[model samples]
Target: MDDSRAKGPPADADINLTEPAPVEASLTDNPQKLKIAYEQTILYARDLNLKIGELKQAEKALRQNAADLAVLFEASQVFLSQNNIETTLQTACQLIVSRFDLQLSWVGVLTNDENEIHPAAVYPPHDHSDSHPLNQVGASSAAGQELIRQAIHTTQAVASRYSEPEARQAQPAALTDDAYSLAALPLLHNGEVLGVMSVYSRQPDYFTPDRLQILQSFANLTAVALVKARLFERLQLLSQQLVDAQEAERRHIARELHDEIGQTLTAVKINLQAMQRRSGVSDLTASLQESMDIVEQAIQQVRNLSLDLRPSLLDDLGLVATLRWYLDRQARWAGLSTQLTVTPSNLQLPANLETVCFRLVQEALTNALRHAQAQTIQVDLQQHDKELQLVIGDDGLGFEVEPTLKRVAYGKGLGLVGMQERVSLLGGRFELESAPGQGTQIRVFLPVPPALAEDRSA
Candidate 1:
């Protein structure tokens, strides 16, 4: 080898600059370096375990949140659809207990006269049995009662444990010894505390802040349902008053047409006949006879007008008689077959119910002739137990019932809508069934109040 070549640096033996560095520790021969790397590895494992634990906790929380939202959504749907107050509150109490898995739940209404709560509904309804301690929820634990009062007074949600000092101070007597914890949320609407919804839990520390928030949402929905129910009740009263006033006006007009115009026309015809008899001249007698004919026609028209407005028979003879007469006459005029069936042959109803039944039939029959184009019509009136039912069926050209009724608001289906409003005002049910090429049938059910039913049976 040349002396100059030996002076050059030797080439590397085991190195690849193109490859990436190894991430795994080599634990080099140096003792200090190995010790430092080992300690760092232990710390990294500890932090990894901590991160895994937090992820599990986050997943559990998300599941609980999802369940709570589902319950709230379902409750909102039910509350909006219900129009009865008692049913709405009862359902709310039932849902809270069943979904949350609690010991007891109840709703109490604070009446205007009483300072304390009056129990309205309870979950695990009282069976009047001694088997279950939770049955007597109306007389709840001391803590539960106190929580309700606090919620009402403060207009806020309250919670307490029976073993707590405050709970013991509320009442020394353990009325709710079975419940370990209690919570109450106020039912508030329009600045008014309507009631309180209370819950009892057998587990300690069960009612957390998140759970209270969910319960408050339920209370808010319940308040909305209460407002809707009261408004519906008021609307019903106003509707009935309107119907009564309209009927009164019709009665007045009918009387004027029949009593005043009818009598005067009859008197004129009588006088004209007398004149014809007294006058012997042919020219004058012929003229008097023609005048008598005109007066008779006028009298007949006046009588028809009075009957159409508000039939006197509806007042004097009752519903059945008026129905029979109207159906018979209308059938003859329209050249169609008609039938009216009265159950028990002596069925009678309250005056308002009677009016509703007759008008319903009248309007239905008119629609059948104008829209259905049917040749035959049938009306059935039956009193079954505490309910009075009327069914009007016709074999005519039929149309979609729902679409036509929906048009009522726009004034196109006033005749059908009028019948529905009349029934609704009385807290009754109305059902209309019709399809193209199918006959139309209208069914109405009016409840006979307990007082009237008793009188009827007697």
Candidate 2:
């Protein structure tokens, strides 16, 4: 009997016995099935584990990207806000130190000679010993110098795991014994290299290609910032130079008028007096008197011209006395009612500050006399803390303060421009307020020098 028939299934009668029995296989005959199942299970588990690892890696990359983006955004904002090289570099250094886990980072700006680079920013790693020779890299080292030069010339990023021969020769003790990696990136703007950014690591292969690329991008951004800061500095220098030249010219003109025209007027007055003394006849008396009157008028004109060029009172006396003299003259000439108020009567200011204040007052009075058709003017000077303030107001039929009015009215009026320039040169604040049917008010605020303030107090 067949072994299957011998073991007949009679316990479960519901099952048909003679159904040509489905193809049957024993565990012993196909023992490889167990091994195959085990292999498939291992592969499936491995694939799942790999997928999980990939997801984690992707998440980590995403977070890093976000962090980098945030840093770039902050850097951009800071770059735009600052207007000078020192502040910009300081901000950049702080940001990099705060954001990156860097061993060493620094910015090297090309010097005027273009052969040397100056350290603008430097961040030393925590583990770096203060006595290490690398500490002097920024000051004097072939490696640092060559890195800067290469970055500037190539306008591209460079990295080196091994110390260059020249650098080792220049600072053998520093590089020969130390195994530090370096990266140098060109800071470029508008296809021009402005500077170099360098980073150092005590460990070999500390930076990857991707990290170098990121640094290069940061360098590009920094380049724009540096360019903007440099441009701003240049503009400021040019403006200051122009102001200095203009002031020098004005002083020269003022001196010329006082020495030349003033002396001639004095001589004319002397001659007229002599002629009047010699002529005693009544017929000639009238002519001589007329001549005397003309000479007196000429003398007055000459004095006025001299005063306009540079007030003698300003140089001889202080701002308050000079302003008093100016107001008296203006009141007499314009025939306008004038009021003067001065607080802290013993107020004295720096020479430059005094000059600015006097000029502002003079310009305001001139504007009122020439254009303001006002009958009454008030001039006030006050001191508070470290500040000196001057306010000149007039009860004039004021014009609109709109741009159109400013362009038309102030175009012909150099008084406003002159006053503004004086105040600006003194590092003061100036404001003009006026509207149609409203009176004009000119206010100036100047910071008093400590020495002058002490002198006034004394």
Candidate 3:
């Protein structure tokens, strides 16, 4: 064969075609296609780059979402920690402005006078310095007042972009000029609108739908706190009224006893003394003296009864003197050995507080004399560091303390329940310690009002 014809193709063609075609390679044994291999490598690199970019974007979004959730949780904790109304609103405003980075945050309650809204609390605009004049108007001003009105009227949350002229005009100059975003959320509980909360930001569209929803949740918590505060106030008022009524009734009864029964006893004693003075035989004289003694005893009994109803000693002398007189008389009458120790004598207390203290002492002594087969009793009173301390102990056969508190038969006559009630009214703590074969001791701790302790020694 000729060499040129045997080569099958020209040298240029053979050199240019470095790899066999797919169909030719399949027919043959092997195929080395470098161009196709290089093209496949380039396509894989492009796909990898695209996947990396997508992953970076997804991570950024996830981080932002986590930050938003953390802020919401912090705001919720702030709302739950407040126990009073004023503090609750203040906390809410601070959280909104600080955590959410808003320019201004405030809360307003609908005024009783249907036309006005009262600003309760506000966080000043972010750019305003603490000493700036504009910072002073967070709680009181025309801007704050009107914002409240708009929130109340809408009843639903309102979010508006500052670029809109209508929205700009509706807002206050301080807010519109300095704040580019604003949102108002209504506070509702049990289908009733209590107030509205408003927030502002320096950047337009700063507050998203998710942020508004979180703010609304804060408003709901505020409503519950306010309701609780109001209810507590009402209860305090009612309790004071009841106390005033009780005092009035006591005064009325005291007057009746002094005017009616007291006068009658005085007249009876006078008549008996007059009869004895009249000339009489020896036998008649002895009989008349005995009758006069009996009349005098009756007079003393009437006086004691009047005192028990309401003690005049409480007003005439201080708590110590009154207690001393009461214990002396009861101990002598009941045939019980009683020792009273009151340190820092002549100390004075408020009339109501004194009355409570006296009654507690009186009841405790009475119970010991009547029920406890004790030989000796001790009453101690002292004052220490803004508190009044009382301890009454008796060397009698002690009984179970729990059963006595429950008024069980073994402790029926202890009067623990009555003593507990009296202590509670004064916002004091009462404790009783007793066990079989041991003496019983009652302890009372009462807080002294600052007004009473001012300028006084403990």
Of the candidates shown, which would achieve the greatest TM-score relative to the real structure? 1
Writing each residue's lDDT as its tens digit, candidate 3 over 1-458 gives 24443333432332222332334344334334454444445544544555566679899878867876787677666655554577777777777778667766777777776565577777653344543323433334345445555666766666665556544544445443543656677778786778788776667776677666766766776677667756655665676567657766776677677778778877887886787788477777787778878867877776777778677777778688888888788878878788888766756778777877887888877777677787788989887758889999998888887766666444465466656756665667888898988988999998888866664653
**Superior candidate under lDDT, 1 versus 3:** 1
Return the TM-score for candidate 2, rounded to 2 decimals. Answer: 0.60
Residue lDDT tens for model 1, 1-458: 24542232233332222222333455576777676555555545554555566679899999999998998899888877776777887888888888888766788888887486778877777665544434322246555667777898899888876555544443324354433667888988976898888887766688889888888877877877877877887888888999999899999999999999999999999999988889999999999989989999999999998888899999999999999999999988899899999985888778999889989988998889888889999999988778888999999989886677778767887897799899988878999899999999999999998886787777
Worst window of 10 by summed lDDT in candidate 2: 15-24
Over the full model, what C-alpha lDDT does candidate 3 score relative to the true structure?
Answer: 0.68
Q: Tell how far residue 361 is off in model 1, in angstroms.
A: 0.7
Model 3 TM-score on a 0 to 1 scale: 0.57
lDDT of 2 by residue, 200-312 (tens): 66555766887777778778888888889888778767776786676567667777777887678678878867877888887787887787688778767766676787776
Evaluated against the true structure, the overall lDDT of model 1 is 0.80
Better of 1 and 2 by TM-score: 1
